[model samples]
Target: MGLRSFVTDILPTTLHTRGRHAPTLVGEPEVETFAQLVDKLGYLSREDLKQVRAAYKFADEAHLGQFRASGQPYITHPIAVAALVADWKLDAQAVMAALMHDSMEDCGVTKVELIERFGSPTAELVDGLTKLDKLQFSTREEGQAESFRKMLMAMSRDVRVILVKLADRLHNMRTMGAMAAHKRARIARETLDIYAPIAHRLGLNQLYRELQELAFSYVHPWRHAVLHKAITRARGYRRDIVERVRSDVDKAFGEARVKVEVSGREKTVFSIYRKMREKHAGFAQVTDIYGFRVVVQSWQECYLALGVLHQLYHPMPGRFKDYIAIPKPNGYQSLHTTLVNPLGTSVEFQIRTEEMHAIAETGIAAHWLYKVGTKSSANPAEVAQTLGAMWLKSLMDIQRETHDASEFLEHVKIDLVPDSVYVFTPQSKIMALPRGATPLDFAYAIHSRVGDHCVAARINGEPAALRAELKSGDVVEIITNPGSRPSPGWLNIVRTGRARSKIRHYLKNLEHEESQALGEQMLTQALRAEGMALPPESAPEGTSVWPTLLRWSGNRNPSELMLDIGLGRKVAAIVAKRLAQLMQEQGQRPDAVTLTLARYAAGGEEAGATPPSLVVVDGSEGTGVSLATCCRPIPGDEIQGYLGRGEGLVVHTGDCGVARRLSARDKELWIPVAWSEEPVRQFDTDVQVLLRNDKGTLARLAAAVASAEADIHHIDMGDEARGETAELRMRLSVRDRQHLADVLRTLKRSPSVLRASRVKPERPPG
Candidate 1:
């Protein structure tokens, strides 16, 4: 029988309905009438179809009373979704998953129950389709992030899970017109931002197209309607152009002795709208709105067709791409080229082999062909890798490291971004990263250790900044320093959340260690001031020191108590008193004079008998006593500490405007703080110098500051000045206030110096 005759004859002739129960299955019932559907799904045997049917029946029974917002039976939605998956010729398990997509959420079906009924594979797919309703989150964004996290992690486990989920989402999006306006908008936005990109990444072209069209309609309804109308009208006008192009391409290929199938392809409404927005053009200004795909039998014919097309029209300059040689990360392979036709209109042409066309159209779904056909050469691993399923590995890693749902969601979003660049490693392997990612992200992409020790990088054989934005096709090589660690400043510029989070985790632990040491030292000094001896490093197994410390700080353990004390959550005076009590209980008594001095210090009076100890203010330190970034206080400045909520004691200069305002309003928040006799590290001080606009003036100023035993950390000069004076903001390192004063004096004595003053940078209230 001819193809048309077979299709027409196999079409359903009778309609059956379970009146007042299930709706009648109407139109094209070839599967039930003649088992044509089973015959066509060559990859699935009769046994597989029987299993799938059993799953469908189970899901139908489970969701018997449930209905969707549109008032249709819930089982219909899953059936439709499953049909869509079957259309992709996915595996039997994936089809079963699609059929039961809503069972867990709507019918109270549990994963364990599904596993017992449909096996682990089907249960896992259903689990992936399940949303995060069980997880508690403070905000809608957090919940959404968490749901996405769960979905992506599931997808990483088995690519089939996402395929089924995408099918489920696609069916819902197709029927979204029945949803509320606000819900439709939100769902559409999410689809455009996430699901569509995921489909594209998986090389599900048909699914991607459907998702984009549905999302565009809800996101920009009016624009979408207008574009649809315009496309319809344009198609009418271009009917002859399409035919002419098709005929010329056919003839040209014939002349070149290359067999090809030429077909006209119209641009989708979403594609047109995107082009118009990106190029800032009106509908009429948009070229390449219509294209032709030339599917040939072999890669050689694809190249031959490309040459034939170029000879047929004036090829546009720099408008050709050879994707066949290096398929996109999504595994899309085609020879794309744009040409100016005889009518002076630009048109795009895509040339590809029949197999490439299949892959391009179905994406990773094409891998199923191996199961159906005699060609069993397809590599499942390669297909999975090409579809970017490796990103799922990171999801597992993220889950292992982070327990916060919100943070997990954030990591998933960072990893799911569609705009990615594929860069080459030194070993010639490819690493994918989001657009605007830097070399540091790339290093981290390879391995966390590489990122931690990455001191420098080279791009394409030339030295580049670690923060340099990577582009597609670039070869990057990381240079590591063995002793190097991730810098705190890197957090400000790193694009990937993984890199940022890892850096923060490292810094937090490092700061805690330093703060513990500092706390220990401060406790020792305070004890010495009380004329008491230091405690032993390790207490006896049954000693009460640990319990005493925990009671004093209201913490569960010694580490927590120490961290609280170091963070200034517990005052030093209070902790010292508790320590003294514990020591007295241990039969250690303090001198009467020492007790008097401790009492005086607790009452905010100076202990003249004891000298003040040293406290450091290096940028490397992180404790409750943090120097305000806004002020960058040096040792010479009179600083006070503010015990902020959650934040420990934030130090600010006494003269800082912010500190003055905070003290005026909340005076009790401020605590007395004095610089140590010998600061452990250099301090940052700001100096403003007004210099006459003269050559070598900045050099002279730098020399004068250096002459005073100070090093310049940063310098900011104003743009062109109106008069002879130019303002310069300089950050200098000094040991003490006297050192800063000496630097200021030397700057005032410099030549061409119009004015000089200590610039007190404003500090943020803690």
Candidate 2:
């Protein structure tokens, strides 16, 4: 008999008769049995099945003493999972991997052993399924993340690895009820949050639905039971409605001269619960509970059937979606239209070709059906290839960038969200984005460089802010600027984790460069204070100076030595002493009197230098020190330094409220610091100007500050009182005490100004 006849004959037995104890067949009924499962191995050659069976037998023996919590033979689980793969019509290697997925982890079998037995391809698949048992993690969250990372990296190399893994997870979820209560909930929640969505994104509707129902049962048992009972009762009452709809669809298709098969579909319990919860309604309020699907012979027939249904029933306005015309990102295609049925209830109808229907129902697994047939129009493998390629490519991209499993999982979670808005590029190429993604996300989705240089954007030919939230069907065109750089604030608005992580990575590297430059300066200044010029541009002759420097700083390399000094991990003075000693041993000496003078002068300079030892506040050369943004310090303010772990000397005013709390709590991090003569760079101070209500008062205040040769970096002007007076907090830069005094004088002279004073901004407590 043909495969189709075999499928038709066995469909009932495979789907419905498994749990039922039926009477034994008499006189050898023509029924497909477990032996047929072996016969179907023709799709994968008999020899391959023999090898797979050998591996299965080995796994069975390795798990001989083991049994599941349900008291079933441990081998039965692998067989069931392998059956799922067989149902998917996977190639021989995938089948072998599925059969031995648990061997490495549960049976203590090694990849080497599997390789020697089943060959390398099968062994690699088994290895990919193994967890990182030997590694230690700081927390369960960390370990889980790392494990996900490894799986994704492995998946990038072979799409079959994840497919088999997902199949394994699906089987486990189906049987999760046998596990303990807490374990069930955790596993179910993970399945719902991670696995189910992944399955959906990969177009695995069959696995997706099963996983959802399984997870829903455990995540909300009471709700699942209630919904299941309600659906069961509702199905009984709606039996007439279903039959009528089916008859109506068939008759309508007959009238349209379109041959079609009509079927009734009921929403799953999990779907019903989700609609109720999401819409904030009771179960009765949820519509679209009853749906009908029309499967036809061709795409043209699908449209004809859709027309026939709409002509028969009134289609709800704006409730129709023609995915066949514009497929979803996951390659799901169907013509969906919701209409008001004869019963005056909203009924959703999905019309598609038989092949499309198979894909819609079974997703990538529909490839199995085509493999068994020779229909010219049916090519499920091509469909699976198209849908799976993009998803696997993205997984590969994420794995290449992230090594931490938790972080990889995070990226996957972000990528897998079902809520996506479809947008168009300037050239009209469609792109789907996670909801709430901004223009920056669109740029990054196109390319990393586009995101990095994206300065502005336009939606529908009108300029929009970079942070503007994108919606479906919008035509987006990113505006690039050569000098634009990503700001720290972008982290707050960007939705996609890819954009966020890339921006953060770039900024971190930029900060490191700045820190390195600052560290080099500090080291040079410290050496100068020690009455020595910088060592020869290269290491001195015959000294092995790099090793000597490493020994002195207790570091691995010169870069690390400099980074330590720059980050205040080691004192500059101590490093200077070591450098001086090294210099003296390298045939360099200083006069006793010159050294004495240098000591006294250096002491005076140190006393007057910036509070942070690394920061040099020169009154003359506008170059060295900077006040911390966290707690901005000005001249004449009592200040202290915070060796902020990785951050170099952060100067905070001593009497500032924020600094006091940080000092009280983190005394070990606090370090002494002072100012230098002729301070070089400008200092920023906050000055609050309380001005009488006036029109041009704000502009005049800014002009006055500018006249005083002080620049205003930022300004906040708003009503502080209910009426009349308004307060303006201005963060302005000044050269020194004299410049700040001049600016304050000018501001005080303004007629509209009621009160003007430099106020110390309060900082957050440590």
Candidate 3:
């Protein structure tokens, strides 16, 4: 029979029939019994059934001596989980995988063994369900994060991995009473916080509600009992009211020439407690505790039935929602409305077609089994392949940005929060983003590159700050620049994990490049000091010496060694010495003439005289070198480079007291250095400006600097500035000494200026 007829036309077997049905309480039937499992096996071929039985026997043997906390054979749990998968009419492989999911972890069942026996697909599924038991973690939370990361990555590759795992968890929760109270509470909390939400997100609403209720019973037994009794008592007291409302709804639909089936959906204790906590309301204030689900035969009838219910009672303003118009992320579609009954108590109603009801009940799982009657224009495969799988697709994107399993897992959790706001692109395309997302979030959602280069934003055609919080219906346009790069400050404001991870990734790459260049420069300077030259990459011996050098240095490649040098984890001079030793062993010696030229070239004024240890600063060194922030030395300033053990090279102004102190301590490490004729980028230098006190004087100082084409990176005001003269200490980015001099000259032209001079360093970064 076809799926629709099988699902909708066929009625589930009653308990007395002893036939296949939805899961029921234990003792009604053993899940492993031929009748219970074989009944659902009609969809599987004879060979498939045989394969499933073989897996069951293998697991049963592996867990032969094992028992659960309940003192039952461990084999029973896998059987029960398998039964749940069979109920969903999943493929024979899924059923087999469920049977073997725990064997790998509990019985030391190997993937190779499973693959040899049951094939790769089943083995893969089992592997996905297995946790990383062999690895040690710093904390239980860390271990859990890592385990979940593995499971989620597996789920992204194949959805059935999580499906079978959820079933396994459900069975465990069902029998959680057999475990210790503390263990039960912990597992239940995990189920409630992670697994249940995942089920709901997957559209398995049947499992979602049951998991919540089961976890609730274990998490707060007393509360569950109290709420259970309260609901029962309330049910008895309101029986007449409930019957009256149902009777009235039926009659209203009948009179309106509509057909509908109404069933009550009760709130779980946890849900009730959560709603109370979130709304800051008492139990009595919870209006939707006992809501009615109205299932109609067709989409048209669903709306017709909703109208009849609204006509019967006054709808509470703002309580109506048309989910059928825009279904949830999980593809759940329904029309929900809360109305006041004649007795003045609030009553909630949900209206949906039969197919919509099935989808709502099953969620993601509905895509596999819910081929109900033609109430839906789209098939389950189409729905599952598209809307329900959107989150699964996003997992790949998140993985692209984050590599650390724990970090990826954290981002996945953040993405799964369910609540989000819908926004639009400049082209009118719609995108759903987590609430509190910013323009950066929008840019990343559009594309990673867009987010990387984004410099500014425009919301609704008006210029908006990059950090501006995006609202629903806002049309966002991202402005990008080739030169503009992600700033470290963006990490604090960006909302989505994708944006945060990508920005971090870019900055990390940029830092590594800078560090590598610095490392190379430091090594060159170190080799020059040793009266030698860095061996040419194309030196004889028929090839580059870097591979040989890298092998001896225990480095994977040249960049890594350089990065180590740049990061201050390894000293450039030491590496250079070892490299020189290698080259000397290879019959190459330092060119004496070349060494003299390097020394004279590096020395200032007294070129050919007894030369000093000479180093050069070009403002273009990568990560391996840096100019001291304390001294803020620019080109044309008398400078000295300090070979700080493993800190590569740090250049400082020669006259700066901080540099003098450092030189005194590490006198051998200090070397004379000169600036390159032209630098690639702007260098930041401090200028102490003395100005007349005036309201616009500060603005004039800024204007003068801007007119000179200088950018003020930072500004500091002296305490004495509030008196007769203002002392503004500004760090300005300039091309060279000429550029800085021009900026100071411009500031002097203003009548408010008294004197301008470079500020010497007081202290240096540690």
Cα RMSD, each candidate? 6.3, 6.7, 7.4
Per-candidate TM equals 0.83, 0.81, 0.77
Report the lDDT of model 3 for residue 76.
80
C-alpha lDDT (0 to 100) for residue 43 of candidate 3: 77
Best by lDDT: 3
- Give a tens-digit lDDT track for model 2, residues 1-766: 1012211221112111121211111112321223544654667776887887787778778888998887877877777677667777888888788878898888889889888888898898888888876689888888777777777666666666777888888767665556777887898899898888877887777678778876776777766666766765666677676667666766776677777666666676788888888899998888788776777788887777777888999999999887887777766789999998889888898888766766666676667655422366755545566567766766766566565667668778887887788889989998878899999999988887888899999999999998899998899999998877787788787887677767766666666565566667666767766677556436453144557877767888766777776676776667777877887777777546645655665575567742225455453211112467755676666667765667666777877777777777777556556676556677888888888877887788878988899999999876455558888889999876677788888888989888888886585555
Q: Worst lDDT window (10 residues) for model 3?
A: 1-10
lDDT order, best first, reads 3, 1, 2
| Model 2, residue 751: C-alpha shift (Å) | 8.1
Over the stretch 1-766, how does candidate 1's per-residue lDDT look in tens digits? 1012111221122211211111111232312211343454566788998988888789889988887876887777777777666777777888788878878877788999998988998899889989887768888988888787788777877888788888777767766656777887899898888888778877778678778877777777777666766766676687677667766776777688876777666667788888898899999999788777888888887887888888899999989988887677677889999999887889998998777887787788777643321245755534654456555566676676666777776666676676777789989887768899999998887888999999999999999999899998899999998999887898776787677767766776776676566556556556655666556537562265657666657888666655665665665555766777778777778877775654565554354444232354444455446887767677667777765544666788777777778778767456556666567788877888888978888789888988998999999886765667888898888887788888888888988787888876665567
Candidate 1 colliding pairs: 636-737
Clashes of each: 1, 23, 11
Query: Across residues 574-608, which tens digit of lDDT does each residue of candidate 3 receive?
Result: 88888877777777778798677765756635654
What's the residue-level lDDT of 458 in candidate 3? Answer: 96
Q: Which TM-score value belongs to model 1?
A: 0.83
